[model samples]
Target: LRQEYLQHFQAWAKSLGLGHSVQPAYNLPLGMQADISLVEAPELESLGFNEDIDLYRQFTGPAHLTGRNVISTEIGARRIGAYALTVPALVGLLQDSYAVGVNTMVIS
Candidate 1:
């Protein structure tokens, strides 16, 4: 149903002389978080100021040197919305990013 609606909207928008292209969505697993603590400092230190490092460094500090851009799940389940947890919950959810030492986050 959603696809149909999008398709109809796209056609209508195009007919109105507006450019409309629906891009593919990026999907991240539900309940996943950044883990920034698992990385070894030496590995991060060894990274050169190359293109790869330039791309990664924008998102995190030495702890998050995975060289992979972090993309998050934009939508969450109702269960997540219903829950109320403490800082530990945030810590656990972000352990992966923490393992890699991500100091900054990019929403997209």
Candidate 2:
């Protein structure tokens, strides 16, 4: 029943030219007929690059699930570090994102 609902939802989403950020292994499947249909990174504290790597695994796990090599992230999307987010911390964040297979980004 869940799979049926998900399939129906996927079809509806694709019909609207949209996709959801659902984990294929957990809930919804990762394939949708949108220009871009993948996971999205949420705000995370600058807990160092090593620790941050795990933060995006959920998002990156299916980054390539759709056979599309597009990976993306949003920079400075955190209030934990505030404006104090230094270059190294930012680099670490980007590096972590890269390590997790993020190939695109939107810095704001």
Candidate 3:
């Protein structure tokens, strides 16, 4: 991620009580719709949740029947890209889980 974007994200997360212990990962799934789930398995695994961490992974694959509550943390800004459009096309890879749908959740 660019330094400016990182600064914005870090500030936003800190204000919301998410600490720096939650490391940020970038550019996952290398083709299209990459940023939709940038903090994927590797990042999540590295977190190794403690009682206070409450770490969650972005959807990695199709949802299994194990009843895990999946959530999305997709946030974006206004720009000149198709992903700057909507949520579905952005997060269509992992098809069967909760989407936490947002057309444009944040624009800063």
Candidate 4:
């Protein structure tokens, strides 16, 4: 059913002269939270960034296999102190995401 919907949407967009496409969120990272509800420094520490990069490669394997070039997903949202994140820290987080094939991000 999902495949049918995706193809239909793609075809509809193309018919309307739009190049929009849909992709599953196969990113391998936390949504500004770890095992906890509110995100903080402690929660960030539990992120899988320290894990093997191969894990993420596998996580996004499905999208790659389907020929989807754009891997978009939400990040850096719902934090304990959302405004406390420094510029460098945010940059580093994005850098790590890029290393795992995150080209477009929806920062909330």
Q: Residue 105 deviation, candidate 4, in Å?
A: 2.6
Quote each prediction's TM-score: 0.25, 0.51, 0.21, 0.53
**Residue range 23-96, candidate 3, lDDT tens digits:** 23433332212322332211222112220122222323321122222323333332465445467633432232
Best by lDDT: 2
Error in Å for residue 78 of model 1: 6.9
Query: Which stretches of model 4 miss by more than 4 angstroms?
Result: 23-59, 79-84
- Backbone clashes for every candidate come to 22, 0, 0, 0
- Runs in model 1 deviating more than 4 A are 1-24, 28-78, 106-108
lDDT of 4: 0.45
Worst 10 residues of 3 by lDDT: 45-54
Ranking by lDDT: 2, 4, 1, 3
What count of clashes does model 3 give? 0
Encode model 4's per-residue lDDT on 1-108: one tens digit a residue.
444554566567778977653322223333221111111101111133333445445434444455556655455543457676677766766776678775676565
Candidate 3 local distance difference test against the native? 0.31
Give the worst 10-residue stretch by lDDT in candidate 4. 37-46
